[model samples]
Target: MRNRTLILGVTALAVAVTGLAAPSFAARDKMTPEQRAERMIKRLDTNSDSKVSLDELQAHMTANFKAFDTNGDGQISADEMQAKRQAFRDARKAWQEAKSKDGKERDAALAQLKDARPAMVPGMRPKAFKRVDADGNGSLSAAEVASASEKMFKRRDKNGDGVIDAADFTKKI
Candidate 1:
């Protein structure tokens, strides 16, 4: 039972990193699940010949895990997790502060705060993502889809070259 609990906890952490690093949740809405799977295959298929080798999978997972292991430790503890979540929240707040009031964009921007609110508090299940869930299942939850109509203003740092597109910056300004 202890081992199972550890495994589930590890899996949940993997899911969080994988989910956050995943193609923007907003983009997933435009394509069907099948299409998204295909895209993932292409993205993960690093060799470009046409398939995902187990090595590639391991490399991807390791890279993502390392990304969160900010302290260079071999493990991701609750503190590390909280640090990551805080980083996301900080970015969200900065972006929110930059937006204007009285428009669809503002409404959309505010929803990120709404989506991440549950995480902000000590213990509250998020409501914004649930509001968008179509099947009422325990899937599809993240501030990534904060607002369905919100436009994507930033280029995703898909390549992970230490920059979001060209700028090595975030919404800090």
Candidate 2:
């Protein structure tokens, strides 16, 4: 029971520990690219320098890995990954049901689920996981997570500035 609570807390923190006041889940859908960048920066920028360094990004990604590696196994299994997915599916189901109700009830449900925030791990698809799991061992380790995060940080640092800022998130339409 305690482990579950700890996992939930860490999972929440890893996904979106927005230091600033974050937008509603509904508003998040409407957020512009620049806005999304700023929100991500607020969550990932540990030093509060308005940007995300590779170290900061890897730290957050490692935290996510820890959360996914429930049971303190130091590696993530298919079961653990599916469990996170199931939680989001359950929340999403409830949210859809609540959508048929009156405005207040729908809004209340949205608040509780926050658009099924549990599965917000970036690019959580099987292909992405395989790419990260360099050993092909069918489980993910902390080292794989570190390597993947470094790659992710470099990919997002579009301007080659060594850190990710609003510019990375923004795109010219």
Candidate 3:
């Protein structure tokens, strides 16, 4: 009875440790380029039609155009793109200021933010902004975006199968 009790306790502890080391259930998780494309195509085909109609395509495109046309001119120019980026900076500054205005010296907070820069630069644009901006909208949206996400998974898959295996995420971004 004593030996059986010790084994059960060890097993329970091991199970608990394994659970703690695993990823949480709520993670949206990163997807490969091919997965991204396949998902986009699925989303675009909302009605399950084999092909996406011009109207559906147009709706998606128009929504994307509106996002990059910051000046409401129905076109996205370089200047407008710059303005949008500046706006994001301003918003971040304002949010940080508001959160830390309790008479705290912000040097440490600012330094921490600076350390987070390298990762953020890539997020500002999806690939080369100009190349992916198929319609020259200066930004990307579902319509302007390409389906290369699934390709990312394919490159990591190694087996060429459509599905990504659990161990393939070791080198994921």
The C-alpha TM-scores of every prediction are: 0.38, 0.69, 0.37
Candidate 1 residue lDDT tens string, 1-173 = 99999999999999999988777867756886446546656766688754444455545545555554567755434455566677668758855774866667677667665553322211112454344443465333222222221211122333444222222133332
Best by TM-score: 2
Ranking of predictions according to lDDT: 2, 3, 1
Which of candidates 2 and 3 is the stronger one according to TM-score?
2
Q: In candidate 2, which residue ranges exceed 4 Å CA deviation?
A: 1-29, 99-116, 119-123, 170-173
lDDT of 2 by residue, 1-173 (tens): 99999999998887775633365555756977677778788988899889889888877887788778778989887677878778778877889899989999889788868744652344377788777788999888888778777877888898899999877766641
Cα lDDT, model 3, residue 58 = 46
What's the best-to-worst order under TM-score?
2, 1, 3
Per-candidate local distance difference test: 0.49, 0.78, 0.52
Model 3 per-residue lDDT tens digits across residues 19-38:
97665543347666656655
> What RMSD does each model have against the real structure?
23.8, 17.9, 11.2
Please give the lDDT score at residue 52 for candidate 1.
Answer: 48
| Alpha carbon lDDT at 107, candidate 1 | 71
What stretches of model 1 exceed 4 Å from their correct place?
Answer: 1-30, 96-173
Return the number of clashes found in candidate 2: 0
In model 1, the Cα lDDT at residue 71 comes to: 76
